[model samples]
Each structure stands twice: as structure tokens, then as C-alpha cells.
Target chain A: MTRIVFLGWLKEMAGCAERQVELPSLATPEELIAFVAGDNQSLAEQLAEPSIRMIINKSVLAGKTLPDTIEEVAFMPPLSGG
Target chain B: MIKVQSDIFDPGAELNNFMQGRTDMGAVVSFTGHVRGQNDISALELEHYAEYTETEIGKIEIQAQRRWPGIHTHIIHRYGKMKPGEPIVFVAVCSAHRQDSFRAATFLMDSLKTRAPFWKKEISGDKGVWIEPKASDYAAEKQWTNKV
Candidate 1:
């Protein structure tokens, strides 16, 4: 199971905080983003944002693999909290 | 120490407790972030990536420690709903000298402004808006020159 979590305005846009999807095996963050968006073009477009960051199971990943051990993937906008 | 909680805390007592039993410290710098009541803000809803908030904060803390050796750090960030005037975040650093502690505290806060995975949704009247990172904040963090 791959849980894709949303935050901030993205959460408001998604209408929920997270969505769980079953993956047969390992998947890239990009792949997971598309899978979670599915047919929602708006969500898909939002996920494409250059500012969007990917975190897999609590580690902020950059050009990194989402291995089979990964259980959650978070799509985050540029953080503003301090 | 990193505590990401919803409860309010007394900065004074917390500061005392953090420095307790540490006699090698000569200077301590603490910063408290409170919810602003400006613009008629009824409350500030803090949302965070539960799986990542603490880990990211811990990473940043460790980075600061590595950058400024011998500096001790404590970070407390609140999540969920909070009204105006309530404390939202706290950062304290203790070191043998003011310079090291000051730089470490500022570095921790500066990195946290943009590095941490927490966001604020400002609610006023009948509307709510997710706050974005200010350009000034990015600039401030940039002045650090050293990326965590």
C-alpha cells in the first residue's frame, strides 16, 4: 500500500488529507503522484509543480527511488512553517 | 529535543528545564513564535506531514549541531488549531559563547522557515488561506550560505 499525503492548499484542493493506493511493487514518486491523481487532471497538474517536493517514508528524496519498503509518499509544496 | 505537539507551553519554564544540569553553558538564545492577531485572524491552523515533521526537524537540528560544534538545541513546534496570541513555535540554543549559540539558533530557525514540513492556514471570518513562504524568508535563509 502506498499512502500519498497532501498538505496546505494542496489538501484543500484534494478535499482530503491523503489517499491510499495499492502498488504491485516499487514505484517512483512521480509514478505515485500520477497514480494518486488518476483522472484528476487538476491534481495531476498540481503534482507537476516544480516547487513540489517528494518525501518517501519521512525522508525527503531528490531524484531518488521509492523502493518496495516505502509505505508512504508525501507531495509537498514549498514549506512556510517556522 | 524536538517536540511537535498541540499543547501550549511556558517559554520561561521550558527554557529553564532545557538548561537544567548544564553548567558548561555560558549563553542561551531562545526564540518564540506566536500566532499573530493581525488582519482579524481568528485562528491559525497548523498542518504538517506527520511522518516527516519530526524527522526533518531532527535532521535540521543535527545539521546545526554539526555546523556549530558543542551547541545544544531544543525545538518545539505546535500543530493543529491555535488562536491568535498563542505560542506556536519555540527554539532554544545553549553554548559556551554567545556567538556560537546565536548563530546556531538563527541557523536552526532560518533553515526551519523553509526546510520544515509544516504549513499554516490562516482563518479569518468566513475564509481560510494557506500561507506561502515569503520571499524575504527565503532571502534570509539564503544568507546562511551553508545549506543543510
Candidate 2:
């Protein structure tokens, strides 16, 4: 099972901050996002935003496919830190 | 030193402590960011990924140190709910010359603004609005690469 975390407005849209789920085979960020968003179109639309960032195992996931032994995946909206 | 805390801190005291016993360093530069009390905003709510936020900022601090050797840097950023006018972030750098100290501090702030994982929401009365970084903020960060 992969731990999925959401931040910023995505948290609100997702309705929860975190969850654990089993991913499908060769799950990329797009597939992971689709799986997480499920049938909620609003949440899916928000998650589909281009600026959303994906972090896996404490580092930004730049590649297309998630590693097989992933621990955590975080979906972060654009940062606006001081 | 890097600190990510929910408790309020005295920036002046932090700076004083960071500057203490640094006789070898000729220049010390510091910046403190406060929550703006404007547009009827009552408070700013900052959310951060507990460990990842610090880890990312630590990477930035490391980069700044590597970019400007012989420099001491400190970053203190607050998360959670804070009232307007309350201190939000503080950065300080000490070096043998003013240019490195100043530029390092600026780099830290710019990186913190654009790269750090902290998210901000402006709270005004019953409404809370998530905010994105301004175009100017991206431009400021891009200055490091001469992209602007």
C-alpha cells in the first residue's frame, strides 16, 4: 500500500489530508492522481492542475512512473511560502 | 541552523544569538517577514509537511552555504495560525564581507518563497483563501539564474 498525502487547497478538495491505498500496476503520477481522484470530478479537476507537484519518498518525483517500492506520495499545490 | 516551529520566536533574540562570538565574521545580514494586516485579513494560516518542509529548506541552506563558502546561515520559519503583524519568517547570514552575507540572505529568502513546501492561506473573518506565489516572487527567484 502506498501512503498518499495532500497539501494546501488539495487537502480541502480531497476532503482529507492523507490516506493509504494499493496502487495499480506501473502507476505513474497521472494514474495515481486518477486513482486518488476517483469519481469526484471537482477533486479530479483540481488534482489535474499543471502546477500540482508530486513528491515520492521525500524527493520530488520527476520521472513518469513511480518506483515499485514506494513509501509515500505527496500531492502539493504551488508553494507560497515566505 | 534551521528551525520550523509553530511557537512564536523573537527574531531579534535569534539574530543576537546567531551573531554571538562571531568576531571573525565582518558582515551580518538579517531579514524578518511579518504577516501583513491588510484587506481586513485577520490572520495567516501556514501549513507545512512536518519533516519534508525542513528537509527541503535544509537543502536550500546547504546550497547557499556551498555557493558562498565561509558563511554562517540561520533560517527560522513559523507554521500554524498567526495573527496579522506577527513574525512569519526570519533569515540571517554572517560572512567576512557584506556582499556574500547580503546575497546569501536574499537567496535564502527567495528560495524559501518559491521552493519551500509551506503553504499559506489568508484568513479574513469567516473566509480563508489559498494564495499562490506572485509573479514578482518568481521573477525575484529567477534573478539568481539571470532568467529575468
TM-score of decoy 2? 0.96
Question: Model 2 over residues B1-148: C-alpha lDDT tens digits?
Answer: 9999999989999999999888999999999999999999999999998879889999989989988999999999999999988999999999999999999999999999999999999999999999888999999888887421
Write the residue-wise lDDT of candidate 1 on A8-81 in tens digits: 78876777888887865546766776777888889889988889877777677877577668688787898989
| Top TM-score model | 2
lDDT of each: 0.86, 0.90
What would the per-residue lDDT of candidate 1 be over residues B22-134, giving only the tens digit for each residue? 99999999999999999989999988887678888998899899998899999999999899889999999999999988888998899899888889889998799889899
| Candidate 1 off by > 4 Å | A24-30, A64-69
Question: What range of 10 consecutive residues in model 2 chain B has the weakest lDDT sum?
Answer: B139-148
Docking class for candidate 1? high
Q: Relative to the true interface, what fraction of contacts does candidate 1 keep?
A: 0.92
Clashes of each: 0, 0
**True lDDT of residue A29, candidate 1:** 67
Instruction: For model 1 chain B, give the 10-residue run with minimal summed lDDT.
Output: B139-148
**Cα lDDT of model 2 by residue, A1-82, tens digit:** 8898999888898889999988777557777778889998888788777888888888888868787787888988989999
Error of 1 at B148 (Å): 11
